[model samples]
Target chain A: MPELLILVPFTGALLCFLFPGHIRDVIGLLCAVLTFVASIILTGNIYQNGPIRLNLGGWKEPLGIGMCVDGLSVLFIFLTGIVGLLVSLYSVSFFSKANNQSLAKHFWPLWLFLWGSLNSIFFVSDIFNAYVVMELISISAAALAALSGTNASLIAALRYFLLAMAGSMAFLLGVGFLYAQTGTLDMYLLGAVTDGGPLMAMALGLMTVGLIMKTALFPFHFWLPPAHGEAPAPVSAVLSALVIKGSFYLLLRIWCTVFQDTTASPQTATLLGLLGLTGVIWGSYQAIIQNRLKLIIAYSSVGQVGYLFLLFPLVFITLDPAWKIEAWTACVFQTISHGLAKAALFLAAGNLIHATGTENLKSMRNIADRLPMTTFTLALAGVSLMGLPPSGGFVAKWMLLQSILASGQWWLAAAPILGGLLTAAYIFRILSQAFVSDDQISCCGHVSFVMEKSALLLAIFSILIGFRSKEVIFLLSEQVYFVIQGGIIP
Target chain B: MTTLLIYAFTSIILFSIGLFGLVSHPNLIRKIVSLNIMGGGAFLFLISLAYHGRSPDIDPVPQAMVLTGIVVTISATAFALCLTRRIREKTGQCLLEHCPDKPET
Candidate 1:
């Protein structure tokens, strides 16, 4: 199944590359749907059984490559599926309107290749393989960012490409150090051999820093807004919604498993949590001030990324199982909900920009009347962004609050609440402009139902996720081994 | 010092220089070159890790990984160079600076 997940999109990408025409989009959509179906089946199989483990070439754990699909991988795989399907649907409409058929040809191959790379990242258990997956994702993503051929996007892609390369090199170097010490690249094996030492600490530090740069955490988040904001809308949605999560997932995998015993000290975890706290405050403030709609959403990603980091401290500070489960649940929930809502927001924003032919929030006055569904999608996605009740964001926030209060870590608990308010403020900026009546609203193109429906469905899912907390929590916790606990240290 | 120590220190120095070049240089091409240098340092480090007391008894994993890393780095560098070229052709500037004259959309 894991092999199928990687093969389907990759093969589709090759087909698209060979046949770059109207047929490419159809092929791309078919591949994405097939991948999603395979992922769902994989998840169901994991549920019935424990975890699925595959040893490539029949080589055992420490000797050759192995892949594991635990609860975490299953959740992320599902996320890639949901977001991949919607983005593919949205892209078909998006690129058709673009009129540059040649660009569409380039887009299908790169996008599907990116989708394949993301699934590979989630499925691979070996750290070095993960590095390769990261590189593939970065290259494809950089190409996609430059697909629009605009000067702004081109520059952004250039900068993004450099940072991603540098970051991955640092990651590779860390992999070197770990291999030197443990003589293995499998994360689970590294857990057994690793001890608290300077080399391990240095390796952890280097890898964490590298992943942070790639993940765009706190001070390193400078490259994200430009890259995500300037890309074509569906591409922006993919980059913002799914690409960064790849590195974030890598960080989570490394910290919890490979570095479980030797790393994640109280001070280091708190330091990360502090950065997450700062990112929430800083990114939300930046989002509120942006005039362009996509920039605002991009900056909000920088903020929401902070929420994921908060889990590190909350999980590290307590030894209680309940606390760990709650923090883990909240963090994963936040990631999924954020991916759905942000993708919806970008697609809807893109449709609005298409209709009005301008990206400025001020110029977007009275667009709600013309594009009701798009506006409604924006509002629905905003509800999740603001952590409103009866939405996935609210559930994640509520769980996070419960965990923080349980641990009595009151200082950092305020970040999420304050971030929510800040999120509300920026979302209101767009929604308010939507209400005003403007006589000279210039619409440049027709908004397709395909585009609007895709955005709306993702937004609705983001909201509906709030109601599925029990099932999601069950799926995440049951029948799946937590790698940190299952590893040799414990 | 042992040969391993010497190689390790050389790789570290190379990495430091590459990181410094990356941070200090404003030109995109220079930055890309710096990235390649940093990647070279990592690859060197990985290869050195393969040296376990003798020539024939080296670790093959890091070698395989280094080989993969080199290919990945080349593709990224190639892509970055192409993007830099495109940016130069479009805007006539290699440095990524925000010109205050043009408004951001």
Candidate 2:
């Protein structure tokens, strides 16, 4: 049954690539829905029997390839399914408006293929295969970013493309070092074999740098704002929301599992936490200074990513021995909430930009009455972004704060809170402008309801996450590590 | 240990040179070219470290990964070039350092 969850997207991608142009969006939406349903079923299976494991091509563990579906993979899987669906819905209206028939045909296949790549990355038992999936995702993402057909977007995509390649190559080298030392690429096998040695340490450094580059953490984030800001809105939504998380999810999983022993020095995790802390300040500063709305959201993503990494160091050993579950639960929850909220925000921004024919802040200040639904959805998404009361972002922030404080790392809490305020500041910058109702409002065509509804629905889900903390926490704690390693680690 | 350190040094030097080229060059195509050189250095470093100090003896897994990374990087570069050429066609200039400020929409 868990196998079905991964297979659905793969088959869907191929079908999408083969479909007739006119029906591709419909087929893609159906595929995303099916993938979501399958994931729900898979979650039920996990509820019954912890983590579900399957070997693809009949390969055994520590030998051939395998799929390990744990709480984290399921979380990301569910996110990809839902986000993939909404982006498709948004794109139908989006590309249709510009009469971009060519892009419409290509969008589904690339998105579905990306969905498959992302899902598989979370589940792959071997580090080597994870590298392959990373490359696949990068190609598709670069292609998607170029869909704008704008000169700025095209150059931005190219720059992003080069950086992603460089990062991937660095990761490949790190995998090499690991394989040399441990003689195994399987995460489970590596867990048993490797200790905090020099080669392994060096490998971890390489991998971390590579992953940070992809995550656009801070110093390495020059490629992000351009790639994200210049791309079409729906593409930007997925790039920020779903795709970027793939590398981080793997990094986190590796730290908790394969690189678990490497954290013994404490400096390693502390250094990472410091980087995240730095990112929060730097990214927020940039976001605040941006005049364009989408650029603001893109820079803000750099800030949010910091919290995820910092939370790692804050919770390394402080949680109640059982508190690993709570900390990771909060971590995963924070990630998904951000994804949902960011997607909605971008979609709303897209529709508004479309209606007003510009994303300039001075222009959108009078955009409120003309596009009320888009305005409301942006505010709703902002609630999640700001970590305000009753939104999932609020719950995620609360849980992370509790974990950090519990760990006695009081410094960590400052970032998320400050980050939230900045998030509120920038998001509200757009929100206030959205309320502009002056006669000077020069706008474009009205957006179709199709684009607005799914976006609102996503924003609502982000808020609804606040109420489901119990269930979501339970799901995140369900043994993702053991699923990959087959409970073989000592 | 000495051999590993030497390989790492060479990789870092090459990487630094490529980085310098990438940052210093204004041409979009040259940046891509420099970036790939950096990638080559990094990949070689990985292969060198993963080599078990013997011919046909190094682990095949990382080798396979490096191969896949090569293909993927090439594919991404191709797409990026297509985008770059298109951008040149439209705006007549690629952003080298400071982008020419177009008044905000």
Candidate 3:
């Protein structure tokens, strides 16, 4: 089953490429449905029994690549299943309306292939395997981003591809550093072998720099705005919404599981957390001022990611370290909520742009009546983005605040409060545009129910996920309490 | 000891140079090339860090990592190349490409 998760989409991708244009959508849909069903079964099987550890070619952990279906990996696989399905379906109508069937034919297979790569990244237990899967995700994503077929889009994709290479290389070097000391690339094996020394330091530096670059963390984030802004709206939606999360997911996984012992210094975590806080402020500030709606959302994504890192300092505030679970949970919840909300916002924005034939903020200012459904989608998503009542973003932010308050980091309290306010300001800037009723607004076309409805569903999930906090927490807790110190390594 | 450190220092300098090129160069392909150089430098630095008592005794992990890095870099460059070619084919102008003039004159 572990191997099949890697197998299914890869085979599907090849078949899609080799086969003719006929039935491509059907093939893509089947691949997503089957992958989702397989994931659900795997989840039930794991919950009923234990982790399924698979070694490739019958090789052992330290010798060959391995895959593990722990609680975290399973949850992410499920997200891939869900998000992949919606994006695939949305792509069907999205391209159809544009009358670009040939483009649609090519898109379905590549997108499904990307879906497969993302799911496998979550399950890989070996560092080298993780590297390979990250590469797969990055390549597929670069292709998808470049599909817009514009000069600027291609150049932007080109720029992003180079920067992404630099980041990936740094990550690989970090793996090399670890191998130098531990002589193994299996994450589980490295756990028991590592100590907070020179090799570990080098490895940590390499890994964090690579993942942060992938995440588009502040200073290294030059590639994001152009790549996203230049891509087709749906492609931009997924790139901003889902693909970037893969690296951050790995960052969180490694920070909690592998680097926990070494990175336990609260002061260091606090400094990292501060870096995140700055991303939030800087991202939001730029987001509010952007004239282009899509660019604004892209920059806002940078700011929102910063809030997740704030949980690090509080992860071990008690010095007991048992509370790392809360820190990890807060961060993950923020990630999931923002991902769902932002995807919906971008999709809705795409719909609006498609209908109006422009993404200018000034034009959107008087075009609400023309795009009723898209407006509703953006508003609902904005509710979650602003971290207000009855929404998952609210609960996620509340959880982080509770932990910071509990840890007596009263100063850290300003981050979520001010960040949320900044978020609201930008969200409202877009939202207020929805209510403008000027007769001077000349829009282009009409958006359909399927496109608008899919956006709404993801947006609503962003709000409702907060209600499942306890269950989600329980689901993620089975493997280890995020920061495992005194346990067997592999 | 000094040989490995020197290699590592050279890699660091190369990476910094690539970073400078990335920010300074407006050409798309040049930017892509610089990025690969930076990646190469990082790989070199890692291999240097893993350099030990002898070449034969050196860490296999860094070597494995460098190999994977090379593959990923190639794949990314391939996709970006595809996109760049498509852009050049469509617009017929690459040097003066800018997005600000989109949607209108």
Candidate 4:
């Protein structure tokens, strides 16, 4: 089933390339549905029993490459499925509305390749496999970013590609060091062999810096806004929603599981938390000042990504056992909430841009009456982004605050609230443009109902997830406890 | 252990040079080349780990990893070069627009 998770999209990508023009979208949709169903089944099976670890080609551990899916991997895989399905559906209508059939044809293969690469990353248990998949993800993403073929977009893609390569190289160096020290590539084995030596510390530093660069956290996020803003909307949605999370998931897995014994110093965790705090404040300020709607959301992603790092310091320092679960759940839930909300925001922003034939927020004035559905989608997604009541983002914030307070870190709690206020400022900025009664403001083009519906559905799910917090927390706890039980390296 | 430390130091120096070039260079080709150099240093580090006490006693895993790394590096460099060419053709400048003389104007 895990192999099928990778094979389905890869085969579909090949079929997409080989098949005729008319059937490419069909193949893409079929692959999305197949992968989504397979991921659900994989998650369910894992939940019912336990994590699955498979040695490829019948080769045993330390010799053969392996794939493993714990509760964490399942959570990410399920996210990829949901976001992939919505993006695939949105693409079908998005291209048709633009009447760019040729570009649409080129999009399917690259998109599938990226989707498969992401699945491979989440499932791989070997450090070397992680590096390879990271490269695969970077290459496919760079190509996808360049699909628009505009000067700005291409330049952005080039910069993104180069930085990503540098990041991956650093990561591979870390892998090399780990292999040298432990003589094993499997993460489970490495955990037992690794010690808090100079080599391990160096490897951790190199890998963390590399993964954070790829994740586009704060200072290294210079390339993200342009790449995201200039790309076709569906591509931007996937890049912002999933690709960035790939490296982040790696960092989380390594730090939380493999290097749990070699936890970074409290100072390092504090530094990371400070950087994240900077990202929230800085990214939100930039987002508020952006004229282009997509650029605003792109910058908003930089801010939202900050929330993910807040867990580092909390998880690293908290001695209370209960706070550990709270921090973990908050981190994972925050990831899911932001993923759905941001995807919805990008897709809806795409619709608005499509309808108005402009990305400038000013021209979007009075578009609420013109395209009410898209407007509603944007508002729904915005509510989640701002962490308002009865939304997934709100629940995440609540859990984060609870943990922060439990840890007696009252000062740290102010960051999220302030971030939320700034988020509201920017969201309302866009919403006000939509609500204004400007007679000259008019939507120039038709946005397909399918496109609007896809964004709306994702936004609804973003809110709906708030109600399912118990189940989400339960799934996260299952794996958290498993790690505590010393189940790996057996 | 001394030899390993020397090799590690050499890789670090190589990596730092590449990192310096990547940060300091304005030209896209230079940046790409810097990235390749950085990758070379990392691959060197990986391959060096395969070396054991004797010449024949080499680990197969790091060698295999280096081979895969080389393939990935080639493709990435190729893609970056293609984008460089496109940027050159589209704007007639390989330098990024971070300077005072912005390209858009």
The lDDT values for all models are: 0.86, 0.78, 0.75, 0.86
Q: After superposition, how far is residue B12 of candidate 3 from its true place, in Å?
A: 4.6
Please say which candidate is ahead in lDDT: 3 or 4.
4
Tell me the native contact fraction for each prediction. Answer: 0.75, 0.55, 0.62, 0.70
- Candidate closer to the true structure by lDDT (higher is better), 2 or 4: 4
lDDT of 2 by residue, A246-313 (tens): 98998886776677644334677788888888898889888998999889989988888887887567
Error of 1 at A92 (Å): 0.9
Q: What's the C-alpha lDDT at position A214 in model 3?
A: 85
The C-alpha TM-scores of every prediction are 0.96, 0.91, 0.90, 0.96
Docking class of 1: medium
**Per-prediction DockQ:** 0.61, 0.44, 0.46, 0.56
Worst 10 residues of 1 chain A by lDDT: A481-490
**Lowest lDDT block of 10, candidate 3 chain B:** B96-105
Off by over 4 Å in 2: A1-7, A15-20, A317-324, A442-444, A482-490, B1-20, B42-59, B91-105
Error of 1 at A463 (Å): 1.0
Better of 1 and 2 by lDDT: 1
TM-score between candidate 1 and the true structure: 0.96
RMSD in order of candidates: 2.1, 3.2, 3.1, 2.3
CAPRI class of candidate 4: medium
For the candidates in turn, chain A alone yields TM-scores of 0.97, 0.94, 0.94, 0.97
Better-scoring candidate (DockQ), 2 or 4? 4
